[model samples]
Target: MKNKTGRYSAYIRPFSYFIDLAIINLFAILLLSENVYSIYFVVFSSLSWVIIALNVEFYEVYRYTKIIAIGNKILKQFALFTIICFAYFGIFSNHSNARETLIYTLLTLLVVAFAKIFIYYFLRKYRRLSGLNYRKVVLLGSAKQVKQLASFFNDNPDYGYHLIKIFSTDIDKKLAIEMCCEFTEKEEIDEVYCSLFDLSNLQVNELVNFAEDNNKIIKFLPDNKNYFARNLKVDYYGYIPILSLHKTILHDPLTKLFKRAFDIFFALITIIFLLSWLTPLLAILIKLESKGPVFFKQGRPGIDEKEFFCYKFRSMRINATTEKEASKNDPRVTKIGKFIRKTSLDEMPQFLNVLIGDMSVVGPRPHLWSQNKVYGNKIKKYMVRHFVKPGITGLAQVRGYRGEIETDVDMVNRIKYDVYYIKNWSIILDLKIIFLTVFNIFKGEEKAY
Candidate 1:
């Protein structure tokens, strides 16, 4: 049942984690004492936990599972965690951390690890007692796909999804046979998942109508291998049906919160600390170079095709306009602008853009209205890039796509990288991009005239 797994499923793991973390942190404090080595132990333990847990993918939580599976997985992951702990510390330890302290920490961590499992076991049992049932549903997919879905349902109990039938066909004759074969005259199906691939428009319509007639919730999970969705999963739950398709990965709530929060937090810090101090000096330089506003502003297409005034330091002569593209050796770029563009100091004003919540610290760099004009018509899925707020630096920028949009192919490839970044946005990925950006700023930075 969605009711049981909805909030409780999330809380269970986080609760288990906090309990384990508290136990480990408290033990480290008590036993390791006021030593820098204690920090190492905590870090080692945390790293070990994530590494082992991540490899097992239990945290993904896509289905319900049995107690045996949960208990066994916890055991396996915790064992891996402990092994990594010993091996990591063994290689890196100095003379101070005696075998006694190490043994105590290990014993303490083992208690915490088993506690995590025991806690889950208790919670699962309590939940079962509470009648926390999975959402009863039926599958409408190919044989292979339906079997895989059924197996997944059977395997992962935490998911809280119970597949009641494998309705592998979507045809009317076959559908009737399936209905007759799988369900008796009195049976009611709560949900009909149409995971069948390569269905014609007529077949899709028929299946949709059938689900609607039965008052059954229908969910379509397209094959991941076929990436073309024409922006399939965007548009705010289909209330506003537009010609364009949206990339769904960017709209995932955690990914959205993470990317936006990173943009806002780092943007504010930069605005207050770095940009605040740097702006005045840059303004003075720009004013001296030419008689124009120190900061440049232009309307850029943002998320959902919304328009916002993007900011940047004026990196060209006053006569340079928004419609003009930046050239490698443009005459409009001032002597100081040349230096700034080469060093990427010009993009410093985008910290304000970042703070305004119009851009990211690192993402698919926003394009001007005119460039979007040129490429939006030319590139397929070009408009989907607006699914999320654009960034100042992105996968494209670091991977040598920043400078000039020389060709349609260049923009296409650039969009490919942007889509890749959009699909794979994470805190760790952002951190890696930021690190790479810093490295590039100092090591072979591209000249953005």
Candidate 2:
């Protein structure tokens, strides 16, 4: 594909990297007060930059790329590079000053981050002022979606896509393909977006072949009814592409690592400090109040709909209508059960579940096995919540969607928040939910039983 940000503007990212690297090395030399420039430092810096380039694709910053996202990617690259540098210095260097090296890393990171933000804003302003850096794109097909996409391009100048041609599939497919090919060949068409719902298999293959022959970028936006499906993920098994219905942010290795680390750390603290002493006390209290086991174990849908024994302090009386959910002022809940439930102290045992890897510290709360079956059938995307491990508390619970499911709307809205949490999962968001959960415990939730 032709350069979307104009040919000359393409060098900006590479040039910025080169300048940033020189500045970092200069700072290192000044800070270290080294007699000779260490070859180890030079070689490591070069190789680390290469690794960062491969990992981040730093030059692939498109017009639609958010400034915050760009800054984040730069920060990630810097973090990785800093880790390698620290390891190198820690393991090998006798004279390495940890404090100085730390200061150098922070300074370089700040410089890079500031440079990236400044450059991004500069480019955006330049594009808006000059009306340049726009890619000439062609749309094939007259589907309603095609028009909607064109509207988006027209509306968002920052997207940098300018539709120069629209070929309606209402006309002959062969002629449309030929015209598209000719235009791509004659003009600087950066991309061809095909939404040809009416095109046959052979015709679609022909269009793809023509784009390949001309070395033009072609993207297929399937006009299938499920195109607007929630949390759609495309996975490639060798050559075949499989469309997954739902996937969560935890699917990312980094996210999984961070969440798992947090889960383990938090669970360990709770289990060791609180549960170690509180368990016996709670067990005694529960035993005195109820005739059943101290802990309530139930089969609930966990990650991937795998049944796992979810553990909680047994709040209700033994065999108290297992099929029926406890409600406010329910007799099934013992006198002590009501207090523990209201304060969310009954859920303390789930920390063990978190430590054991059956649950996360923060995620969609698990539903009862039978409730999962019933709601999974009634609600459209109910089971999608199980894509991630069930949590002690979740976005839904923090947003007052917890407690008994009273209506179909209640379940649907709960699932909606679950999906939202899955899609937009972040460490900050998880912490916010945890904070809110704690806050709710203090302020009290009306739905808490």
Candidate 3:
């Protein structure tokens, strides 16, 4: 729990998965390949395993995960895997005998299940004995649930949660919250536990912002009076329920991999087929009307509030107020810039940003640093938009919330759409947004400029 190498604990689950996959494929080649193509079986079985595992969250075992939960996951995975194995034979028209196939699957699952449970209990024993893979956590508030949680952490060392301190807000709430933030910053606290019944909306927001900004996990200890929102994930540590902010779909490794692969493919096609020739053509037009760079690059806040330079075709003249948003018939915009911006051509350069991993094809548009600063504090959950990569075209843009935030309401609506997109993201939704974006560009949006 106190090992310096404990920071690498995040890789352990993925490593276990790799080992399991190896065992599966090896068993397939050895036992199930007599009458079938070994390579085909290996490929099909491997893909099936990964897909089923992800669906069942087979590798999400945690320190507090019950043995019964692990068994449940194993059973679910094995059941689905068995079905896929039979379906594989039917689809490929292989004549492998049913009894032989069943035996091979049963053997493979037995070995895989053994490895899974071994790693799970081994980590528990390792943490309890050596104190190696532990998380340093701090508690906030003085609610009854908070006290129970603190006791739970103290009583269960095998869970690997080392309680650093408890900052009780009973005496002086404001000062205690401030001191807790300072202590968290100074110490190596991995997680913050806030009791929902003891803190106000403002205090909870402050704690959430501090935790997110510093890359620490923040969880809420909900009281019976509080409603359990759909956006919060509920986990049980013994009989006590802990609520965590639900992570978006993009947080899943498989989902991220698929989205990234799609982004690269889309960006490559756009660059090769369109941007290859269009860049120089727009370059001349931009240069003829403006005495500045052909491409405009500005720092924008991306995922996790990290700053990155976003690229666009230069649509405005050299100006002192480059950070300011453009207005209707603004003198700063060049003739070519007007056309390009109106036609959504200026954003074409961001395909390179997508290719380089700075952005996505469809997401919340990256905001100027100035806009983030202005709206971040004024609007609740404004910074939540940064939870995912900014995009070239987004749901908000297609919904007529793009360009020139004329009022705070415009940004509020945009944030609503952005959060919706993040919470309910899918490949079909992304493709739909892309289609709408193209249609918007051709049909001309009212706020295009």
Arranged by lDDT, best first: 3, 2, 1
Query: How do these models rank on TM-score, best leading?
Result: 3, 2, 1
User: Candidate 3 has what TM-score?
Assistant: 0.70
Please give the CA lDDT of all the candidate structures.
0.65, 0.76, 0.85
Backbone clash tally (model 3): 2
TM-score quality measure for candidate 2: 0.52
Alpha carbon deviation, residue 65, candidate 1 (Å): 29
User: Model 1: per-residue lDDT, tens digit, 1-449?
Assistant: 01122432545656666776777667767665364356677777775665566567445432334445656676676567656655765676654455646665577657864775566566556544553644666766577645665676566454455667666554553564347324621354545655536355566566654543333445555655443453344211112111113335566545555566778888888778887778899889989988788888888777655678888788787774757777877888898888888888888888887876777788778887788767764666575577677888889888888887887778888888987877777678889988898898888665455
Q: Worst lDDT window (10 residues) for model 2? A: 236-245
What tens-digit string does per-residue lDDT give for candidate 2 at 1-449? 12233433546756886887787787678766473238778778776766675567654466666666677788778888788778878777877677867887888788777777787788767766777876788888765647776776777665556789888777686787778778876886868877646566677677655654344556655655454454444432222233323435687545675788899999999999999999999899989876889998887778756677889898898774776778879988998899899999999999999998999999999888778657754665575686689999999999989999899888888988998998899889999999999999999989999
Q: Which residue pairs clash in candidate 2?
A: none
CA shift of 247, model 2, Å: 3.9
Which residue pairs collide, candidate 3? 1-131, 1-132
Off by over 4 Å in 1: 1-247
Runs in model 2 deviating more than 4 A are 1-246
**Which stretches of model 3 miss by more than 4 angstroms?**
1-23, 38-43, 98-107, 110-136, 143-145, 151-164, 172-191, 196-218, 222-233, 245-300, 306-340, 352-358, 369-374, 404-410, 423-432, 443-449
Q: After superposition, how far is residue 126 of candidate 2 from its true place, in Å?
A: 58
